[model samples]
Target: MRRKLTLKDVSRESGLSTFTVSRALAGAEGVSKESREAVLRVAEEMGYVPNLAAQKLRGVASSTIAVITAGTSNAYYLDMMNGIQAVAQDMDQTVVLTDIAIGGVYDIGRERQTIQRLLEGRVGGVISTLTLLPESVKRLEDWEIPIVFVDSSPPEELPYVPSVTTDNYNASLLVGAHLQSHAFQDWLLLVYPPIWSSRKERERGLRDAAAKAGATIEVVEAGNNAASASKALRDCLGRRGGRLPDILIAGNNPILLGAFQVARERNTIIPDNMAMVCFDDFPFAPYLDPPVTVLNERSEEIGRLSAHMLTEIMSAQIEARKAGKPAAPIYTNEHQLQVPVDLVVRRSCGCPDPTRSRS
Candidate 1:
């Protein structure tokens, strides 16, 4: 059997320190051009190949992008993850998915712990699906770990952080208008809490629309999962003495399912008995009994854009560090973008097949 060469052998032949040889072999910064060339030449002559698995076992930092998500059961995340994974695969980067939700609910203690874990792991970058606490955001920034928020934003105090999301306010307005077109006077919005941050803009738009149309809108808060949403809807209906709202606006996919479950338990028909609409478009949205009206927020596109933006920042940071420059990720106005949404009209909103949308 032939002896497998090592960095030590390259170091012995090149007359460079083992540390320099290792850095040169990894193509990392801090090695001079001439030293790197000599190290490469010696390494080629010695037939030394870097072992990635061994490097990982030795606690070396990895270029793994972390995607922090809440409400993992929501179908919206599946398509979003697909988009992020596609970008990561193309970039030859690995992705780690971390859910801060415990028992299908977002927990502050878990958020704090997750942040510390990622920092300790020395991850290459992060893509968060919710607005993290101010302290968590601060800690990540202080560590120079590039982060991109997808479907969310930075803390209000850190307005310059990069984010890619839908224009939720406008999307809400679009939803409200379609509902108003059906002459719905009483509205009910079943939504998750502000931990997601998107709830704020979405509620604001709906509120404004309700006021403009002189319609009464009731907002119901629920956990970010289907079970909680189902209970919230049941409770709200109980308080209303079983009086269903003119139209029900679901916050997301999970909430939508919860609403459907409640409707089923009561033997209620959609549109005729009570109309329905939701924030996100899922695979089964159009295939349901009556189909569903939805605000197509383009989740996959948002995910892809967020990952691309993070990778670009990471690349820039690497180049800067290589040139002995400040390596913090550079963010600009362009880094914070909101993709427009389209209203996909289906029969659930009382629209006929001819009135159905193509979005």
Candidate 2:
């Protein structure tokens, strides 16, 4: 029988100490980048497979589930994290939060590195809000680690992966119907770049609805931060000669806040002059001066479902291994789960709140 490749072999091939080889492959800190890369390359070339049994034995008392996300500053992500923690605490599983620098454009190199670091024997599974490259998805599949996506999904080119996301298209359709009820004609939609699937779907739904209603819709691609959103809104308003749209829709809470800043600075009136709606429902949304209308995406529910799905997949994989059977893929045609959204109406959308008496 062929001898199984070992760390000593990788150490010898990479001209590094055994300790260095082990630490590098395990993605430990303090190792030079050059040495880490060399050790990983040598191990791959020598077909050095990780000893899963030994790794489990070493840390049998503790196992972690990693949640990878971007833009921790957003309250949306924080809400989802809270839901995930609620479930994780009940199960007595440790959840580790990791952030990646994903944005409008996919960064394959950074994503791959992040996944490799998580795979170094500590994390038993992952729940990610960031969409990963196809290659990275395949790597996770080959390693037999379960991954459940929240709020985003892998590219269409890849096979179906277990994911939990909101029905954004339907949510936007509801927004469109609400706007139409007020006989609003011209519209302006401030959205993040089209790289995100959620953004694309929402835009599609709005465009389709607008086409049916004969209302003109103009889309502006604002960046994913408050500063960028403010700049984009200001520029769009300037180009229009200070004339606001009949109704303005902000893609998310951050974008809505930016628009609020600009509207206040320019002294724009609400509902009577221009109606406003936002896609996310945060705690402060109802407390705003006009109490902005918003789409409640049930972020906490998404997190709970995602964590539950990941745990189920991991449990199945464990059972399969114990029976000496190859683990089956978690995703199938039925794996796509969509949580519904609710529209909360307030003064911003020309709807009167009963709590506040009309003047």
TM-scores of the candidates in the order shown: 0.82, 0.86
Stretches of model 2 off by over 4 angstroms after superposition: 1-20, 23-62, 102-109, 357-359
- Write the residue-wise lDDT of candidate 1 on 99-134 in tens digits: 998546988999988887786577889999989998
Q: Which candidate has the top score in lDDT?
A: 1
Among these predicted structures, which one has the highest TM-score? 2
Error of 1 at 169 (Å): 0.9
On residues 145-256, what C-alpha lDDT tens digit does candidate 2 reach at each position?
Answer: 7788888876677747888988888888999998888888899999987655688889999998787778999999887767778899899988999889999999888788
Error of 1 at 336 (Å): 0.6
Each model's lDDT: 0.87, 0.80
TM value for model 1: 0.82
Candidate 1 at residue 274, lDDT? 95
